[model samples]
Target: MTFVITRPCCNDASCVSVCPVNCIHPTPEEPEFRTAEMLYIDPETCIDCGACVDACPVGAIFPDDELAEEDEPYLRLNADYYLDHEVDAGEPKPVRTPKLPEGEVHVAVVGAGPAAFYATEELVRHPSVHVDMFDRLPTPYGLVRAGVAPDHSATKSVERTFSSTARKKNFQYCLGVTVGEDITHDELTERYHAVVYASGASTDKRLGVDGESLPGSVAATDFVAWYNGHPDHADDAFDFSSARAVIVGNGNVALDVARILLTDPDDLASTDIAEHALDALRSSAVREVVILGRRSIADGAYTNSEFLSMRLVDGVDVVIDADDLELGDELARQVSEGSVDSTIGSKVRLAREYADHGAQGADKRFVFRYLTAPTRILGEDRVTGVRVVRNTFDADAGRIVPTEETSDIATGLVIRSIGYRGVAVDGLPFDDAAGVVPNDAGRVVGDDGVHVPGHYVAGWLKRGASGGIGTNRFCGQETASSLIADIIAGSLPAPTGSRDDVAGLLASRGVEPIDSTGWAAIDKAERDAGRASGRPRRKIVTVDGLRAAAGG
Candidate 1:
């Protein structure tokens, strides 16, 4: 019987490492693993030992007979790889390591996000290797804890894996450490054999329109951070007094923000959402959230899981234009006709259900507005409304083209969730147009055409903004492989001194980094604080609070 890998696989490849016969085609070490949309097991070579089934963290694996009718497609998807390729079962294969190493190496990874955590995990595999992980925030996991919507707790489970990796003695987490401001690139390079920058894109891409700078206008990134209790955004205020709000994007983040505003405050109170934001949301008067997409519904950017979660949220109305719901192209037709279960199909089903309920002028409405471009923000001081231009779908070009016909939508608050842009790290060569460090695979590329030796990047900083949390595992593996190759090639530079020397240098420069024990204290404090409130864990949302929790 065939075993299928479903969408929930998350690309973490936890199953790949556990297959005794190396039956998993794209092991994390394989070159194809980097680009494969998802992992596939070679059915022909399978011993059906069910080792992979037991190893999967997200329950993405299923036997053929047990496969749900909707997931039956994956059975063939798993078998297709073996049909085109030959598998030598008699040949001896090297055992795979969930952890592997190249040699004696010292590495410093910036940021404690998923990317950094994965890099550290890979780096610590070496018997003689050590890693120093840095983050500006006192706590780590970047967006996993801060940017992810509270309702998506399953997504945040990645943190437990990250926590497990952080426990490695070789992996040192340096929290509350600002790279450019506190410690310079030169200093880090002087202390480690190589430095991997996993610091994710921190800024939001702006919409260059009038009234976007109004008082009530805010970037969805900051709003997300505020509600998630990100220390940087703990005190930031989001005005939800307006009965109607406009969200200018069609991505998962837009859906996340909309659901957060509309979800029952009582439901959120039990989650890890910041107490301050919870209090604000409890009193929120927001009744309608208009999610605007410049392109047609077909081009909207939320995944199936995210869209389904939004639809399943209680006490919210989702509206979609019936005319605009027509399938656009061959892929869209396939999805609409039920040949595939794409995210758009889920959205269409959800939209139809909401449409069937009929529009009630009073209850909260999540209007999914398609083919609209915000032309101007209409307000004197604070946001009162927005001017929008009608957009026509350019099917040939596969984009939205704005038209002269314009109209106004009454909105008290405006949230731009357009996109995320990476900021330049000091002393690193950044491609302003791409909003990333110019890198070849994983090596940092300089403007003068020389490769920056031992400097690397992964995740959103290496690849453009894309993929889910598990995507970073492969991204980080690639970066780590490149780093290991450089070390094996004797191209990586050696650290000038020991960890003590590095810490002394930073302290001399008036910069103090919280160590592992310190981070543990902070973690305990957050958990204890959450326990006090009957929630999962309330984060320490400020530098001072984090420092104090860390026993400073």
Candidate 2:
């Protein structure tokens, strides 16, 4: 049977490289690859060799007949892509490792996230290359361990690839070492042939509306971190005393927040969700989540996969108002006629179906409201409500504008999931307005517009916060290529000190960096604890706890 690409597909393109017949659409070489929600396999061209099933890092591919009841829709979804777009079954391209500088090329990568792992994966392919990866946290896998919703365990499986990379003899972990605080950027450049920064966007975008800084209103980033057991937010106390929570954006993250609020706490108990967050969820008074969008349903930012998943939650009713889909006569007609991209058409269609189904008196409600923008958050002490204004899509300017009508939504909590903003790396020149390090093709550029030698960046920090977990593969590869090219040209400076010297410096500073063995001990401790509780793993959610688990 032909394989179906299902939800949680990270678009890492590993499957694309292994497909013997090149059945996957939107290969990394294609323009649509950047925007594709998930890669689709062309059923007509399939040899059904199961190469993609093995290559898929996230385990998103499965035989059509083997799909779970909830994922059966993907069988049709994969075929639908080929209906609209033609497939070129060209000779499949194999994954290749680029040749690097012959001698030992030492590199230091900051941040232990997907980008950092992917960059390290590329760098360690050479026999003589050694990488020292650093992270501020005691544990690794920054967002994969901390940002992804707990329910998405398949997405977390990409950690297996990262684990393999970490096992390479040429790679070493320097966990719990904060670059700026423990070691300066200048020191990193002085100690390694090249320094790659893969630290992801750490902060969230704000509503900038009045009362946004109030206690009840919080960034979705912090909430995700809190729930996912990021040590930084493990002790966070969320006021779920309110029956209704309003999320002020309609991206996948906003949906994730809504799902977490509405999902049965028992359903999450087996997952890696933090114990404190789980207890809070079990006692949460939240019953309804209202997700607001500034534009029409056709222009919503969330992907079709996420939208579909919302409907399948066990006890939650997905609500959509018919009025929200009534864009002007012309625009509505375009959506109905499937004149827009297939993904957008599917979202509008799904929304209309939900509107027709109406609310089913479920225990929890997920409400979607379009053409609305928050003018201000309401309350004196904490968020009691939000003052929102009606909006209309101005076709000419291609933007949404506020209308005269206004309404107040009474909600005790407000979550802004607008987007993530990259925090400035300690010594890197940053564009404060854009929330990204100023770089040209992964090379860090200074305010004077000159490339800073031996310094590079990848992932969200390099190109704002966009794309999913797998997108970092291409990003990391690009940055690694730039570093390798510089090394070949002798543009990078020679290292003044050895790895032993850096270790001595850390020891002098009273910083005991966790190596791969130490992290493995922490991993085993967490898994052992999780086994007793029948969970994936009970995450060690504090620096001291993690260190103790690692036998530090």
By TM-score, the best candidate is 2
User: Model 1 reaches what TM-score against the true structure?
Assistant: 0.86
- What are the per-residue Cα lDDT tens digits for candidate 1 across 135-254? 988888888888888876656766777888888878887888889888888888887889899999989999999878899999999999999988778889878888999999988899
Per-model CA lDDT versus the true structure: 0.79, 0.89
Write down the TM-score of every candidate: 0.86, 0.97
Over 4 Å off, model 2? 328-330
- Report the lDDT tens digits of candidate 2 across residue range 50-71: 9889999888999887998989
Report the backbone clash tally of model 1. 0
Worst 10 residues of 1 by lDDT: 84-93
What's the C-alpha lDDT at position 296 in model 1? 69
**What is the alpha-carbon lDDT for the whole of candidate 1?**
0.79
Q: For each candidate, how many residue pairs have backbone atoms clashing (under 3 Å)?
A: 0, 0
